[model samples]
Target: MSKSIEAVKRKGKAKEATIESKDQRWHCRNRITLVFGSNDVEELETYTYEDGKLNFKTVDFHQAKSKAIEEILDNCIDEYYRGHVTEIHCELSEDGKSVMVEDNGIGFPIEKVPQVYSEFRTGSKFKDEETDEKGFLHRTLGQNGLGAAATCLTSDEFKVRVRHYNSKKEQTYTFIDGALKVKKTKPKPFKGHSGVRVELKLSKEVYKNDVVDEELLRKRIIDLAYNNPGLTFYFNKEKYHYKKGLLELAQRVDPDTAQEFGASAYIYEAKNTKGKKVKGKIDLSVALNLSKKSEEREKFISFVNSTPTFDGGFHHDRVRRLFVNSIKDKLARNAKKEKLTLVDNDILTGITFTIGVTMPNPRFESQTKRKLVRDTHLEKGIEELMNKNIDKFLRKNKEYLEVVMERAKSRNRFQELKDASKKARKQKKQRVEKLLDANERKKRELCTLFICEGDSAIGGLRSARDKLYQGGIALKGKPMNVAQAAISDILNNQEFSDIMASIGLIIGVEADVSKLRYSKVVFLADSDVDGGHINTLLTNFFYQFWPELFDQEAICIAKAPLFEVITDKGTKYIETPDELETFRETTKLKIKEIQRNKGLGEMSPEAWKHVLSRESFTIISASDVSRAKEMLNVCFGKDTSLRKELLMDEDSSSSTSVSVSSTTTSSAKKKASKAPAKKAKAATKKKAKVTKKKATTTGKKKAKKKTTTSSKKKK
Candidate 1:
């Protein structure tokens, strides 16, 4: 305040401000950002199509500079929309500093060329409520008429050559240094198709860098070609022509999955400024490339009129919201049946939408037209288009609906796994309530976990197992077939949860062998058919999620002895009937008593000791993962027919064996019965023969004795 007062006292009064006026060219050169967009360069995430593939990249994008060139191209597109242009040719110079655009269209009057290119707010397309000869409103890309003129005023040298179709006259004009100098040629009769050509080099002082991006320029030209059907474009001697325009572009992104998504055109009526009824048409083209396998987020490439709406404003939002609602309404019943809540991402992921709209007098947020502003007519057009075509689209793309459902299921499963992981981490800190832990805490890799059949088996194992290296856990019954159960179901089961906690395992995570509580997991159950089933069930549980454990030879099976035999030599534990037969045939010891164990609870301590003393167990392994998976599916999958076939095959084989055994037993019984009868007959005949011989011998003996007595009496 003191400095201000001192200055005021010295000057005796405040100095009056001066006002100055600036020309259009001077204003455009200084405030180029306001007329076009940002003056400096920025990084833009964009995509381009090449080699039949779409590639995404981050590029240095200069908005104002790009808009300067697009302004000229927009003029050509405007002429195309009016049905006067069919082909546009664009080229970038070798030095990348200058560009030329030529279009084959009916050029305006030759005398208006200089004013059209150099003056501000002075060209055509300002009458928004007018209609063309067809009684439809004029739909064009240029409405304000300042684009080409502003571009002309911000350039180092701007040249224009126009050949009027009606007049059959041609003229050329050149403006130098922001139109500070102007030159023109005399009008003359022309020979070729009527058109206009413009060549310009942007001023380096205003642009900071005058060189144009050649790749971006070519991309823009090709986008225009795709946006305008039946229009031909040439850039750097390369030709681009499309009949199905945006649909062709969508196919370029992904040919197999691309399809049209909406109706082509919507027409409405409006009153002009003169209160005359006029028809306004909104031509819409929507193409979508959907991928069921991709995990990426959705992408949108949209345009209003012929301008690329990179920022995607009202049109994009309206279409996206409506499309999502349409799909949600269609899948509501299915989602409810599956107990799922579908989010926008689940419906929208892996989809690329290419949308193009041509409407009269479209509004934009800024002069660059990167983003569109809301328009009532456009909104109503979109709503009507979606209502007319969404049901048909869904009907045709049934697999797409299935894909959305599967995505929802996967998202739900992922969240369940996350919650399970948190619960598992909390459980990992506490002791497993039912686990009989091993004593080897320092080196857990040396420990073995024996998953026994029941509590009785675990009790026996507790007494017989080596406490230092062996641990035991009991299964209530067969473990859940993980293939048939949901992740949440498996996680909620008490037995499975305890097992994972005991073994330091986390669902949905890859197992590390060294970090596991036990190096070897052995399934110990009764040596019966049910026990065999339990072992297979356990194998499927481990192998379905953690196959690496099998690869490391950590999954194994321990054979529980079915028989304990006491002999004169020693006690033997026999695991199978064949093993007992082999031992009986090979040993020389005297036979004693044999005890057969019907279940693990009936096994003797000696049998348990024999099993625990084994050096190693039989490892369960799969050489071919595909075959194993198929077999498991047949056995444990939801399809009962597959399991029925497997069991029927097994029953057929068992029936064959039974039939053979019964036939052998019957023949053996016949042979034994016949031998007994024959043996009895032979014994009776021998007895008779012996009796006859003995009688003869007795008579002879008596006669001899009487003769001897008479001889003795005579003596």
Candidate 2:
């Protein structure tokens, strides 16, 4: 009989007992006939419910039980799916769907194989990864031997077989209540044989996510095929469908002269375990065909232990400095300038290298082992190693460096467009049906494009706007980054064409986005924070897509009032309440308190017309763009927070509050309302709440007070 162990937890203590694996098979999978198995430690807990939420009241963990079982289970899986078995002879069936290997040394004992599948089982970690090392990469991140049970949680239809050398007494077991029923089954005694085999069909839940598992699993199989070149891994599955990423560049230009090889890109030297000196080898692999973007800079990708560092995280950055430092001498020889300020892009781009180092205590970035953060050494050793090796390689590869630098300087931002133009010119096989289907979804929708805020005192402006002005007004949203997009991807993307279609503008190759005709172009963003930012993003997009629109002055930003006042007799909207107060003082008129306006949404629709109009609004006057580009850079450029600091600087002479969104239509208009920006920091300093009181003329109260005075005089 196959034996199993159960992990039980009571009020405060833990308990374990042997049980049958068959009954518990349903606890993992639905099929009763399917045999259940585990190859790791088991942790159990009893939970109590409080207010419908369950809390673990007690827990139990079995670490050492059935340690042999899990390793056997993993071996079976790796063997069945083995792409290329390392040094083992494999035989294939007629269909190649299944194969039996001849040299799987030390197969599980058939009697012990049942015990391996039982619960509360595990395999020791120290023996894996070529050493009894304590590393997460070798160990299955804190899992008790429960993988077999977890598999049953998805699929129940699976079977396993095992045999060891010279064990005549063999047994086959079907699942019973947490146990296996072991009737004396005959073993097919084979020659030179020892190994376990497992076959499984994934249950519906296991392979969900719209077949995401198919791609990852396929890649895993393919990676194994290439990785273990010496292994005899049999493959019967159909070819996996995915665009094999280009390893060699396509023929873009013919070379006239002989090319040189043997120059290394990076070399690393580092000390290994036991504090002894060792050299680390890092050879960069590159594909330098023009088919790869001509502007490609340091595209050399780096990896430590098969982890791709695309973002060049902190550890990668540490090593990148080493790559540049090694070549600094070589770089200096090329330029007459005494020093070159090597930017982040220069040291990176167009380079790919693998750093194979001896990290005995491998601390991974994650359980899946995608990255190594080098948490312990601060990656200083990797940086040192990179410098030593990569510098030598740089001295020998000066010619390639010159070519890369020239391309970087010469490549413009419009290369993508040129490539698309070429592809369309080739007249490749036209997939007319797919193109028609794609066009069916391009229905136009109506939307009002608002480019408000640059126009001064936007009173009664939108009210007079003609509905048919789409013929004259330009309405487009911000220009988006389409650098890495496909031609069709850009054409169908909603963000690209929605605003243009919404405003009656037709998208064409020659027509710029700003030049597109629209019903209205109004800017109605917030008046305080980020008003200038939203304005600049919109303006930049317009300038990028349609510079011709600026000539017609079609783009306009609507200005709204900053303050409102209410008195007993009337209410007034003011550009600046301080000015209104001054106006009242100069006129010697009794006035009520002022309240600052919040946003366009705060005002009613009627008040919206009164506060946010376009006809009375002044268009932003174009200035000699001496500071325009800088202003654009401050708002939309990389150091936005720095721009915020500059605007808020207490020591600057000409600095105004960064919240200023609109420039005046004329210098006179710009000089007219300078109070709001002058007091810009007041908005940030204190968001004060002011309630304007409406004075009420109460006739009864006035008469009663007068009568009381008259009565007192009579008395």
Candidate 3:
């Protein structure tokens, strides 16, 4: 450091920095990042469609390298815009170091081919105030004219072939080492479609890698196909063609949930410098795939003029804000009624928007064209499109509105959910005193929770259960009917709190099956009507809060055997009396003993094993939520009359009782005999009066017949 400092201090004179200007090829090769974005590889989170599915992954992306290829493709898209092209083909070489793009279009004049591919600021798309004979401004993708030239200048070898339609002649040019060496073929007569083809290997010195990514290249080509509905694209040999491009892309995300949001072709007139009124058209297409169950943030795959806008700009912002506001406005009244405020995420979450806009002239922030700048015409067109279609979309998707409302409610209850989550985590860590838990510490989905009716039932369950996969928890009595109870009361009840905590359930939050401690919650109660009531009560509790668990077939019932028959061969557990009767009628083995179990606590160890060893339990599910909710309300609501009506209806419809003991029947007869004697005597007198009336009518009829007979004899 001391020697360096002395050398610097002893300097005699300052030398001026040398200055020189470089050619277009050198400038483009050395400063490629400025023209084509980043030359270095970066990790980009994106998705690709492969093998009939969309796969999202982080991929190594080289923006500048990709942009170089895109420049050649953009020319074809611009030609397509002018109605001169229909089909485009792109191919990657075997080594993956070079790519080729060709289009079927009216190729430009043959003489301008070299300059077009070698010089900067040279192309046909520079006019901003000009219009065709139809007085419409040209809609094109390559506006700056530097893209193709820059790509060519930054390539190791750029080969171009052009067949001019009017000239009926073709020529080929090969520019090697950034056009430092050039070779040309003589113009000659040619056959086939008139178009341009470009093949190039990107310069490794500039891009750091020459190899092109096949998946990303194919994705880009497919994106172009989707952006232009009528255009056809061929990547390698596979063809990609779509009529409703953006909508089809949305469908690719989720076929059942995808739909077209809106489409509009807006034409506006503006005055040119010559005072002539020229028209400009903006074609916008939007599609969306919305999921009610997804908690992920919204995603936008947007494009402008057939260019993929990876970094969304004004168009994305405008459309997203408009969509969110429209939903919020539509749900404002409902939110007010529920005392909740609608948020953007409530409307925007779980949505994938595929947006494509093609306009006469589009402006981008950089040469890579990854984002679109603001345009007044585009803004007005989007507003008009949203205004025309948003209400219809809202009207058609009423369930979507309900989901949004639920999201708002969840947001408002965030603190309560947080507290529940904390309590559940604490409970998960602490050992529960009454829980006979499974030995499986990991892979909790393999575990099953047997919610027993009483603590005595837990003894048999613990002894008979598969310790690795089966767990047991006992309730003091019938569980709380959550349909009629407040959430606070449910959480405060020790039995229910333990059940929720043991199963990793949060009351206000939706259940994620992967996060649950047990894959199945099996209600193991008595075989009697009281046990049935307890099962229904527990069903009501789980279904009222986490109906998704029911949808997933996680809520189940393990039938406790009513009759444990000791056969000569082995033991057979029969769940119902009818089943026992059928077994008696059909079984070959002789039954040694038929022991009826009124409750799970009375079951033997062998019977418990028979119940627990079964492959599957009876899944409790509701196909129609509204009907299930109504029935549960009738069964468990605060209204006593509804319960009475339900019970009376069931009693009148059923000729035989489901389960009745001999002792209960005798007690019922005793109560009937103990009714007051006065009332009993009154009932007997009413029956005697009806009998006397019938007897008198019969005697009168006999007397009338005898009178008629005597009169006839006298006559």
Candidate 4:
């Protein structure tokens, strides 16, 4: 034990020789000692543990420096808590190496300054009794005095300047590297005010990073200001002033929380429990709002002695139990009239609470106080006190209470509907499963649900498809226009309900994807305009709520060929005009006949088997679902203007093609109709011209004969 003690001491004050050859140094070897003291400085005792389980762990220097700053700032706050200070001003150096805080409180005794700096344990505020002659027990922070001593010992320099207005004197003490360097005392002819100003810079050798974080320091300053009402805090040229205490803080955290409650926030300060004034009173600030979603959880923030008890203790539990019980009891009496009752979870789901407590001699689990321990007296005291206040508030605001009860009723109704739907879906699915023979197949095999347009289509699929791996659901006529209908309407439709049941899916808010029965769902429809429309309707219905169904290769469209051509070579199936052209150009075979499949009813079972096979079909995939949704909206949405424009453009182009064809046919008919009339007219003109020529020739022949006879007579 002696050797261990010597080793620890040497390590704590290790010289340069023990340090490694590195530019940076670390002084994490110093050990902590617990100190207890009294009003008289001579009776101080230093405590140490000799157990082998002792821990000499080093703390993070950034955090240690922050705690040191907090210790100094907390001392100033203690003065305010004791009714000694009114204002506090904190300033951080631009380089963020040091911090200074000055207050307008009564300064401490100056003669004991050197001893307080050099000694391990020496200070005031240690009393066994509840109160002294002045009735002041000092319920303020830093009652142990270890915090201040540790801060000075860990710093490179600690300076204290005091102005004693009461004594009309001034004093100053300076500590350099844990030693008292200078102490000065002088008379102030006219002392303006009295307070203590402490400025400190942490020792670089003791801390990994000694620079102060300005933003974190500001938040702490503001929080202190908030908790200590009527105390002003100024830092970084900004002022934080809060007079309403926790109520103001709750408002800042969530502003609309109180307003939505249909009443102002409920603020209560405990006066006494069971007609006896408690030593330290607890304060409560509560805000409530009825959640539209019943799944939302309650939120709570708690504090003890202005230090956050992030891990809640007995006080928080007491507050919650009392609050919930108070409301539940009040609602029980009106349950019959309101036709409902509520549990604790239902009542707690809509509340936001902030609790504050101030204790004179508070106990914590550790020196770095992250949590508070049980205080039996405080627990019972706060519960009894809060019960009455909460009861009064609930009774005063019956309207808000009604809203909360109504929400419970709504949630209950919703749960009942969901349960009923689940039951119905299970029963229907069982019935369909029997028909599908779904239990006979292996679970890992590829199973598909084939949705066809009509009973005829289903007949074709049933004969052609492999029944063990394929199931069919035949939609009557066309599927309901899902875009313009509500979910309830769709569910109530017999065809859609049957289709949903066949697929083992529910059609409402509690829809579950994991419960889906089929691995793939393929729409097998006739290759026509009506078939495309039905496919569109089905796609819209599924994409509206369950778009994730398409993430896997589960949903697709399988094509059915429109034309079957028999030729000298063999029979070929064609879906588009280009396919026909390719068949004629590539095969160059003598065509026997062409069979056009107007619908699925025209196809024989063998043809259906040939067409429904995976190789002969084109499966269209939705590459961009968002773009598909946009197109579906324009084509199938309730608004008809956009669809009307598109249809009009298509019709105008089709009408133009019809008009050109009809115009060419009419002109050819007119030309054929005029051919006989033109032939008769030409024949009549030819006859008239020949008759005139014959008449002229006859006259000329008579003249020539008379002239010839006259010439023979003359000869």
User: Which one wins on lDDT?
Assistant: 1
Better of 3 and 4 by TM-score: 3
Give the TM-scores of the predictions, in the order they appear: 0.84, 0.35, 0.66, 0.52
TM-score of 4: 0.52
lDDT of 3 at 489: 67
Tens-digit per-residue lDDT, 129-175, candidate 4: 34433543446666655666667776788888877656766687777
Residues 192-298, model 1: lDDT tens digits: 89899999999999999999999899889989988987899999889999898889888888899899987567888888878888899999878898888888999
Candidate 3: residue pairs that collide: none
Better of 1 and 2 by TM-score: 1
Each candidate's lDDT (Cα)?
A: 0.86, 0.40, 0.85, 0.63
Q: Candidate 1 vs candidate 2: which has greater lDDT?
A: 1
Q: Residues 1-715, candidate 3: write the lDDT tens digits.
A: 4655444464668888999999888888888888999988899878898886667678999999998899899999988888899999999988999899999999988899889999899999999876766778988888888999998888899999999999999999999988899899999989999999998988888888899999999999988988888898999999999998889888888898899989999889898888888899899999999898999999988899988888999999999999999888888888887778888998988999989998987999999888899999999999999899998998889999999998987786675556666666566566577888899998898999999999899999989999999999999987777755544567678898888878888776789888888999998988776777777778778877788997898988888889989999988888889999999999999999999988888999988998999999888777767766766666677776865554444332233222211111222223334444556788999999999999999999999999999999999
lDDT of 2 by residue, 427-531 (tens): 222332211011112221221245443232222234433332311122223344332234445545544344444343332233443333342345555555455
Candidate 4: lDDT of 566? 89
Best by TM-score: 1
Q: Lowest lDDT 10-mer window, candidate 1? A: 656-665
Residue 669, model 2, lDDT: 26
**Higher-lDDT candidate among 2 and 3?**
3
List runs of model 2 lying over 4 Å from the truth: 1-103, 118-121, 126-149, 165-188, 205-216, 237-321, 324-341, 352-361, 373-388, 407-715
